[model samples]
Structure formats: C-alpha cells, structure tokens
Target: MHSKRIRAILAPVATAALVLASGAAAVTAAAPAQALENGVARTPPMGWNSWNTFGCNISESLIKQMADAIVNSGMRDLGYQYVVVDDCWMNSTRDSAGNLQANSSRFPSGMKALGDYLHGKGLKFGIYQAPLDKTCAQYFNSYPGATGAQGHEVQDARQFAAWGVDYLKYDWCSPSGTIDDQVRTFAKMRDALASSGRQILYSINSNSVHDKTGPRRNWGDIANIWRTTEDITNEWDTGQTNGYPMGIQNIVNVTVPLASYAKPGAFIDPDMMEIGRGGMTDTEMRSHFALWAMMASPLIMGNDVRTMDSATQTILKNANLIAINQDTLGLQATQISNDGTRRVLAKKLSNGDVAVALFNQSGSTTTISTTASAIGKSGSSFTLTDAWTNATTSSTGSISAGVPAHGTVVYRVSGGGTVTPSPTPSSTPSSTLVSAASGRCLDVPNSSTTNGTQPVIWDCNGQANQRWTFSGQSIQALGKCLDAPSGATAGTKVQIWDCNGGTNQQWNLTAEGTIRSVQFSNLCLDVYNNNTANGTTVILWTCGSAANQRWSRV
Candidate 1:
C-alpha cells in the first residue's frame, strides 16, 4: 500500500455515534461540508481515464491521441469527454516554489498546453493526485519523491484550475489516520477546489485496492463521485491481481448494495470500466458495460481508444445504455434479486420507462426472467426494447431471455403504468401449486392444521395439503394462508398461518412465474438451494431468474 498521513481533527462524540449507529464509516469529525454544486455530473460523468490501460505510463502525447480518437471516432458526440491522465504525470518532486510540476520529459508540451489541445478538440481535462506524501505508483513503482497534495490542497487546486483541469481524481494512496482524519483531509481538498475559481468535477478514491477500511458513506457529501470498491481489472469474475479484486462481477457485488447513495449529483463509482481490455469475453464486456450503466457509475473508459476494434467501439458507444446512464432521474439500479448464478436489476427512468438487466453469472447458458410488476411496473400492455440489438417486443408483463454465460440482457421497458397493488381476486378456486424446479406440489406436511407449519416441495399428491387457493393476494391451503413471519428476511422459511390479511401473506403472482411477497417484493418463494429432491424446504430468497423460484398452477 502507498503511504500517506492525515492531519487530525476531533469530531463531536454524538455525531460520531449517530453515523456509527447507521453502520457507516464515521466521517462527522469535521464541520459539515456539502459536495460542490458545480452543476456537473448531474448524471454520472462520462469520460476516459488512463490508469487501467496505461497506468503510470501516461504522457502528453498519449492523452492527445486519446482526445483526437474520441472526437474522430464520434465518441465525443456520444458524451465521452474528460481525458484524464492518472498518476505519474507529475514530476517526482515539487518545484522551487513548492508547487507540483508536470514531468518535463514526458509532458514537454506542459499541462496547460495539453488541456488546451483537448479543449480545442471539444474535450475536457482531468488529472490525478493523492492526499499523502506519495501516490500509489510513487511507492509501488518506485517513482521518486513526495508529490501528494497533503498540506498544499489549496495551491494544487488553484494550479489545476489554471491548467484547465475539469476533473480531479483525488486518491487515498497511503494514509495514516482515523476514518475521521481521512474525511477531514478529503473535505479540505473539496473546499479548495470549490474556492479555486473553477468547476472541477471532484472524484475521490478513499478506499484504494490496498485499503481494507471499506468505503465511507459520507463520501457522497464530500465529492461528486466516490469509489465504492477496489480498482477493477480486465477480468470477468473475481480473481486477485496485485492485491486488488480484479473482475467485473466482483466489483458489481461490492457496488450493488450501495445504490441508495447515488443521486443526481452524487455517484457511487465502482471504478473506471475495463471494457475492450481483451481479458474478458465479448459477452462479459457487454455485461460489464450494461452493469455499469444500470448502476449509474461513471463511464470512464480505461481501454486504449486510439486502436480499439469495431466491436469495442460498438460496446463503448452503445447509445441506449448511455442514455440510461445519463437518465435525468439519476437513480441507480437496485439488485431486485440474486440467486448466486443469476441476478436481476431494475432502474426507473425519468421518462416513465424502467430499465431491466438479466445477468447470468454461471458458466452455462441459462434462462433468466423477471416481470414488469416485480420491477415496480404494471399495466395492460408494455413495450420492451432490447438495449443492445434494438429488438422490440410487446407483453402484458413477462420479461425473460436465454442469457449466455457471463452475459447480460438489458431491456428498456416503456408503456407500463406505475404499479398499484390490486386487492385479492374474488374467491379464486383452489389449485395444485407445483414448483418449477422440483416438479412437485407445495405440500403442508401431514396435512397439518397447526399454525407455523412450514411448506415443502413434496410428490404431487391429490390431497388437501397440496391444494392452494388464491384469495385477495393470500395463498391458502388447509384453512391457512402462506405467510412470511413478522420481521422475516431473505432465507426465512415460509409457513402456513391463520390469514389475518397481513402484507406478509399477500403475494404477487407475476407473469414471469414468480410468487413475490408483497411485503418484500424483491423476494420470491424459492425452493431452498434449488434442491429438487422431494420434501425440500421452501424459503423466501431474493427474486432471481433461477428456476427454483418459479412456480406454476395446475
């Protein structure tokens, strides 16, 4: 890990307790500071960074080439703007006046000149810095000297402004301090940028690949964009490379749960993208780009743009996915369900459309599905447009596809009215409930009338225990309704209890064949662990496209 230090600042005890109680890293030590209202990154910033592809090998000429390619390849028209030169662009040491300078050998044209060249081509300029005495490469790559901003936050901010820097990637390379100290240090830079007489988009990496402190929640309040996971490498699934979790799937897992923190101006960055990096399959690359767009993450390309192939260009310039990422609603897609191998995410667009992504993580091709209602949509008719191929389909609600291994199928669904939970249907006749995975009946063991009797998948038997009736959203069998116990959570075993008309007992029989609990719509009646053996238990798990969670009436 790169080493750095933070000047300490005491925080109020009560404020610290409040943040800690909420399960967030305590960052209340400093006086409250708001993210700069620079009117940029209202939607997640779209740009390119040199780190993933070039690392510390950046130079003025290479950045110019990227800028020229972005414009000539029509990427600029599609919103790829900022051309950021990551660490190593700075000299190993400060100048006589204690100001940081561009490495004279690589950036002979100078920082301002490089920025001017990009601006001349209708692009923006971005740069990197650390809060400590050395950047990650300065320590790890043995690049000499103390180039970090540390106590010179104001001076560096002004210098960046003077150099026409439109974005700042403030990294937490090596830091010595409490979480409070880190927050204070980052805030000082934020303040410096705000006072720098320019609107620099503030991006910070408080949790580097080497840091184990996890992401701090208050980052949304301190910077426009904040890194939520370790640096992402060009791989499809989790594997450690240089101590960082390297893969698209690993970063997605780390970022999905942080959706609530993203809004119009604040974005939860999962790190720059690795699309077209050659380490992942084309399918996996599509999945990666779609996932980032769905999550409202910054679309900072880390691939060498100057020589990208047509397929790479196509994926990078996907207009529909780009629009979804730049949606004015600025809401990050929520992981509605994940069954280890299959995951479903949904985000609402400002124009009354909902974007849904069905991702298959397993090695084999699998059928994945979700319903409009499950994704917070309902209507008599809906239009589904495949985000990649532009294939259009109409449906009442069902959305499904045979997604390839490590692939994602994204759909922009429109024409659905906002969902309004309907009252229970009037006296629906009893039917045998069969599990799609087990081909067995949902049976109450021994025909037990005892309350709290858990349901299980058993051999299809023509008995009262296997007969279930739907009434006003309740699934009744043997004089009881299927219920999720109070305070029930994912993995909670579902049981038969007296139907008191509670939300937990109400279920939405979706068109895609899922029986979703109304109380927790994101969960479904899952055959435990996808085990098809007779007498397997039934529990509520996240609503995924997995067959174990699917059910049918007979």
Candidate 2:
C-alpha cells in the first residue's frame, strides 16, 4: 500500500469537473498512439507480489517458500509465474562504487542466486525501486537509505539485468516537476532497461495519489504495465486506510474509465491483488478478482500463497476467469449498464466469445439482467458457460441472474455466430454526469442508497453514487429518480427519490449538453453558485447558456 507521508506530497486534488473533462478527452483519443513494443505482457501478467500480506518484512526465504507453494499448490500451471519482491530488499547504503546492494541479512545468498532459484522452478523474478531519493518503505518505515535510481538509471538497469531480474516496479515517490518531466524521467528508465539487453516488464506507479495528471494516455509508450490508481487494501468497498481510499471498489471506480487504454504488451495495473488477505469476505474477494480480470489488469497476487485456504485457492485458480484475462484479443471489458447496486460489464474475446459479468454491489440478492445485443453480440442462439460453477445454459439473447450482494457471476458466451459487435454507441444509458463548467461528476453524498439524498458535484471517482441512467424522460441512480423535492422551484436542491412518475422527477437531456427539468423546461440542473469544489450542492436554476448548467454523459 502507498505510505501516508508520500501521499501527502500529491498535488491538491482536482475538482470532479476537471477529472471528468480530462477523462472525456482521454476516452475520445484512447486508441494507442504509440505503445511500448517491449514484446512482454502481451496479456496481463499474472504473478505474486510481497506487499499486501508481508509489507516491508520480506526476505529471500519467504519468497522462495512462496515460489515453492505456487508450484506445489498448482498456481504455477495456472499462469501465476512471476514472483515479485517489493520494497525494503535493498541495503541502507549502496556498496563501494555506488552500486545498489541487497540487505545481506535478508538475502545472504544474494539476489542473483534467488533469481536463479526461481528460474530453476520455471518462474520469473521481479523487484521494486523508486526514481526519487528513497523507496516508500524508506520514508514510511524510516528505513535508513537514499538508495534510489535518480541519476543511476542506466547503472541500476544494468545491475538488475545482471541479477536476472525479469520485472522492475518503478514507483513514483515524492514526484515533482511537470507531467512532461515525470514522463521523461520514466522514459529514461525505459530506455535504460531496453539497452540492458534483458526484457524487463516495467510497471510504474505514476498517479498514486489521483493527481491532476488524470488518466495518462501516453503511458503505453513508456511502460509495459502502469498503475492506474492508488494502492489497494484488502477491503470490499470504498474503505479508507490512513486517510487514503484503498478498497477494491475504490480502485475499481478509478480504473473503470481507463478501459480504452489497455492493449497487448501495455496493460493497466490496479496495484496488486488482495485476494487471500483476511480483510474482506469470500464474496468480495471473488468480485475483486472478477473485476480485475475483466479490466485486463495484471493479476499480481499479494497474499501468502503458502497458507491460502481452499476457498482462496479456488478463487485464485479459476481457469475460466483466467482465460478471459489472458484472452489473445487483449480487450478490456466495458460497462454495459450500472444502476447503482447492480452493474453489467462485457468483454470481447478472440475466439468469437464474449465474457460477461453481472455484479451486485448491493447488500441483498438482486436479479441483474442484460442482453447479448446490449453487450455487442448478435446470434440466433448462444451458450452461456458459468465461469465459476462450470454450469452451462442456452440463451437466445437475454442473460439474467440472481446475484448475491457483493458477488459477481461471470459467463463465457460462445456459439454467437461470428460475433457482430455493435459500433460504440454515442451515449450509454448509464453514465457519469459531468459538469462542463466544473468538470466534476453529479454525485450522491456518501454513495447513499436511500431515498431523499441530495446530489452534489464532486471529483469523479466512477462510484455507483456518480453513475446515472437515462430511461425514458427520467434520470435515475440507486434505482431512484432524480427529483426536485416537494415545493419544487427554480432554487430547489435536486435529490433522489423513489420513482413515482412525478413531473419533478422527469428530465430532458438537451443536445446542447444541458439537463432540463421536464416539468419546468425553463429550468436546468446547475451547480450552486458555480463553485468547482467537491461537495458543491446541485440545484435547479433558470435554463441559460451558463457553463455550470451544461452537462455531458460520459
């Protein structure tokens, strides 16, 4: 996980309006302009990282044991091949000649020997470093050292290649300067690694604090796998740890909008997996895994493989889910619909198959439904194979399931003759309502599922609270209609209420990018006082050409 101290150096949080505006631009130009051709990570890399479970207390013996367990537990044959050692492996000081060295006490036989051992077991080796003055552990745990690769990118790259390093996690610790400077700094290491004559999978953490950079579309040209959000803790929803959003859902929200950036050899990294970590329930873990795989993210497990229970093992070793993740098409899943508690995501596969996920983010069993045509499939008949249970069923087009709360049902849809994928629609029914003036999202306070919660303009996190669906003339979220509240007028704050077909609950999305109240067509949804800060109240005001009243569905 990211250290609290390092996170403090992040630039002031951008308003949701700015985030949504940039995200819109990114999605428009998401086609890979120039991607790294390192010839690695053709599919999302699957492996284990020593961070979520062990943190900085990692050792050579522990890594070796995990490697042994990976093979003995059948994870190796399941495509979990990389064994990564995160921060704190380096000594407090560099050796004579200013060369980085491993802490002798932890790895007495040295990194080269450990790498050789892993290679002998048919696994790859990965290590971590920072481009700044120190690693995260050095700052958070007060580890003695300034062992960074700031001015020694070439030297360190050669050193790691000599040690048989197959992967390098280049982290951004206390990054300064403009985004261009950051890009150049990272690309310098990329070049150095290329010259090292070893194919090292470079994974970078550039937006660790959700800064103003937004989703960097140019990252594909610099690194093989790039971290798209802050570190992930072993929690289900948007839980906070040390004042930072670190839950699975929190990270998922940030990642969902970046689906267009992933391609073969350049995958998105949502940090590492916390599957077997004891912080979440089994249902949540399964959902977490399903979301990651659906997003085409690197599946770097962060749990103790040697001690994983049967349930944990089963979730991690699901062959069907893994197949979707490693699909040769290298396409990430797109959100077909999201009605707060329930969401549907679908990805296109290489063999004329489509992977669909019905996710229930609620607290009770809910019947989520979607159609093959909605997911970009055209078939006379389709075979739906349950990814988890291996149960098969036939369907003409409709796909529905009673998904448990915090659980997901994934299916591989085959027999869809030649797969006629629909053209990307101009507007999705479900979308993040972005304000043109502020660039933030229209959001419900605290992701409340109850009725009568007023909405606001906040930084876009892609959470359920920020997702709204346009059905008929009404805009809805959490299965409730956006209402004008009783005694409605031009200045009334907009709140969500049970859909009653009320005039105040109906809306009309104008071609000019304004959401006008159907009952009061002269009035428009507005950000109170044109404030661009998070938590700004959203109210009804006279329809005008003001930018604050202009909204876009993303």
Candidate 3:
C-alpha cells in the first residue's frame, strides 16, 4: 500500500523534472527580479486555515464571519492573527493581462476588499496557491485552463501583495522537477514575496512525500512553516483514506525526526489541525495541542471558529502551552521513549524547564512514568505541573501517572538541570537491589556465570548478582553490566551483558528509588506487570510509581 503511494507521487515528479529541464530558461525568466529582507515569522505562526474544515466551500462572508469570531472568541487576543484562505478562491481564469482573479460568484467584493476587512479587525490575511500549472483542487478553481504560479511567480506574488495578502501558502500539487528546480521555484516565490514590498509570511508545502532522506531541498531556508506530513483529518487515531490521511499520532511520527531543521524563523509543519471537530473528544484535542506545541509546530486552527464549544475554546486558548511553543529558543521536542503501547516525549523550554508528555497508545489505560535523569537531568529535584489540569507535584527523581487510553498527561518539570557528582567518582558503591514492594534482592538466575542471564527477584541471599556495584553510570552485576538488550522494548527481558559503554548498559539510581536507563530515555527498570513473585522477570517499561517499578539500593 505504501509503495504504491510512493510510486504514484514520484512518477509525476519525474515527468515534471524532464519538462522543467527542457524549459529551464522560461522558468527562470518568470522568477521575480527584486528582493526584500522580509524577516517576519520569528515565532511559530498561529492562525486559522480554511481547508481542513471548509475545503472548497470558503466564501467572502464565511471569512468575514470567522474574522469576527476570532476577535469575539479571544483568539485574536491569544495571538492568532492570520485569517488564511486556503484553495479554490481563484476565478476560472486570469484576466486578459494575465492576473489571477477571485471567484466573482463567491468573492464579489474581491480579495483586496476582504483583506481590508480582516485588517480592520486587526487580523492578517493569508492567500494560498499551487506552484504547478494547476492545484489539486483545479476543478473548483477560477477557470478551465487556470495556470498556477509556475510561469507567473512574480506576477502572482505582486497581485497577492497588492491585494494586501500578509501570508502566502505555496503548495506543491504538481511536484515534478529536480531538487534544483524545486528550490529555484520556491526561491522564485520567496524572492517575489520579498520584492512585493509586503513582509508576507512565506509558507511552503513541498508535500510530505518529499520529506524522506533523499536529494530534497532544505525548505526551512525559505519557508516560515513547511508541511512535513500528509494533510490531517478529523480523527484522533489513525484515519483511513484513498490518499494519505493523517491523524494526530500519525503526524507526530512524521514530525519526530525533523527537529533540528526547526528554529525561530522556520518550523516543520504537520499540516492543519482538526481541533474542535466532532471526530475527536476533548481529551484527544488536549493531546493534539500539547504535542503540536512541544514540536514547535505552527498552530493553524482548522475548525469553524464560530461554532466550536467551550472546551475546544479553552484548549485552543491555553496561553501557557502557547508560550512554550513561541519560546525564543525555538527547540522542537523529540521522542525519548516508545515501547509500542506507551511513549514519552520531552522538550527543553527556554526557561530551563522540560515539557514532558506521557502518552498511552494502548486500548486500555496504563501506568506510565519517566525520571529526571532520563531527560538529561540527574541528582537535582523537580517540580512538575500538569499542563492541562494545573495540578502540581514535586519529585526528586521520577514522575508517574495513570494515563487513560489514547490520552496524554503533559507536565512542565522545573529544576534538575545540574547533575550532582557522586561523593567519590573513583569509589564504586556496592549494594543490594531490594524491591520496594517484595523486599527481595534482584538476583541473577541460579547465580549463573554465563552471559545473557536474566535477572529475577529472590530472597536476600547476598549472591554476586544480588550484590551489585554501581559506579560511573553503570551498575555491574558479577563483573557484567546489568542491562536491557539492544533495541529493547516494553516487556523485553532484562539480562546481564559484558560491561560495554552502550546506553542500554548505562544506569542511573534516582533519588526517588527508581532505576533509569540512558538508552531508553523515558523508561525505567520495572518488574513485569506488577509481579512480585520470585523469577517474575525484570524489564524496561514506561516509568510508573507502582510498587513493581520502585526499588531501593541498600
């Protein structure tokens, strides 16, 4: 299924490349000559797009109503400034002189008048276009033979700027061209917007299919926010579609690896959101919002602002979460741990705090946790505040919570930035791993001298494996490192291995009496399934405060 999708997208691109190469001069001639240093979009853009909710149904009246609702609903005050018209706004064809025209039937007052109205409401106006000869929604566009901005880049940009457009969303509907061709076309638009004497936010959508590790252009160099995934749908979980249909989770997976490309002036977009829509619950909305913020993604709301409920309003207006998103540091979060059923993500905030999210991906509710050490903060204590509930707590080491199925618990953890050194680094501390619940020692099966021996809980027999030495971030059992296997996931059996400096072998004994692994960033040494019986097996899982995950070294 995935291969066919890739092939379908690539074929057009390859054909377009040959055509573009043949007419290179004509394409270059269309590029704008003048340039302006438009350094807008220092922070991630927050606005409302007309595509996800309205699609091809956008009109001048709907836009005006949305603008009014944005102000009255306090969205404008919350820093959502742009009112963007996505696609299908253009007329059937350009004028005799070749200028794009608004659909007379839908936008009789024209785009300029609409931009003026939005500006009067203190909102910026955004316009959308396709770089190709036609957009994906070409059938609904202005005219039968309507051309995109491909051969009229400068002219279209000037028209948009003359219409008082403050933002430009350039889509890659017909993505056929070489890497240089794509870059030149995008740079042409960027140069055009710059020369238009309008400091418009240049947003490019190269389409997510081009995002894989390949000879693709660096969109971050020119775009304020570039779509990194498929278009989002109004679903909480995975959505089914004929083409690429993305839900919140699917988008996050696509966004996980593109963190380094994002910064103050640019962000990796996961496409427009479906917040406040009927397909998802409030809990799912909260999760979606938190993840987007943590990723430093553009918050382009895609719901009918005039009709959403109060819960949706509150989630959208979350000032604290928004602040994290617009932080001057502009660092996107990365997935710290994912063991199939549960996952943990952490982002570093500008104020020396970490925004951590524990997500329950399973169908059933599960206990999840992560320690301060797991997030690069060891020794010091942390104070956590639930971003959604405003609940507060402090932990010297680990934080745990019972997360509902498909729900997320986001916390802002402060302090714990400095790692306190051991009283004596040269001295290795030997201790017995006493389970906080069973009061038994962590024992190597049968006191075996072989490698790959799994660990277990047994009566305090003072065996070599039970009597472990901790030093230099490694816990050694019988001269081998107590370890979780490489690429270990939840329920992967824990065993002993030769003391290699791998992350799976590195351990940190936290102040809260939980063991953390550097390799599994947000995972902890946990007893399998709350089992306290002898030989119950030990493994790495999402951190939790349950007795099974708690241990004391003595």
Winning candidate number (TM-score)? 2
Which clashing pairs does model 3 show?
13-176, 91-142, 92-142, 92-143, 369-543
Predicted model with the maximum lDDT: 2
Q: Which ranges in model 3 have alpha carbons more than 4 Å from their true place? A: 1-37, 139-146, 208-217, 239-243, 418-554
lDDT of 3 by residue, 21-81 (tens): 1211111111111212367777789999988778787899999999999999999999999
State TM-scores per candidate: 0.71, 0.85, 0.69
Model 2 C-alpha lDDT per residue in residues 1-554, reported as the tens digit of each score: 46333443334334444434332221222344346899898999999998888877889999999999999999999999999998889997888898999999899999999999999999999999988778877766546664889898999999999999999998876735346667888899999999999999998877443331134344888999887666677887654423254677766655665666789988878789999888899999999999999999898999899999999999999999999999998888877766556778889899888999999877899999999888878877999999999999999998999999899999998886554444331123347788888778898786554567889998775545676756677787645679987666888899987666778888887777778888877889999999989899999999987788888777
Pairs that collide, model 2 = 16-439, 16-440, 16-459, 17-438, 17-439, 17-440, 18-439
Residue-level lDDT for 425 in candidate 3 = 13
Per-candidate local distance difference test: 0.77, 0.79, 0.72
lDDT of 1 by residue, 154-261 (tens): 999999999999999988765344466778998999999989999999998774222211253447788899876566778886543222554687667556655656
List where candidate 1 sits over 4 angstroms from the true fold: 1-36, 208-214, 239-243, 420-554
Indicate the worst ten consecutive residues by lDDT in candidate 3: 24-33
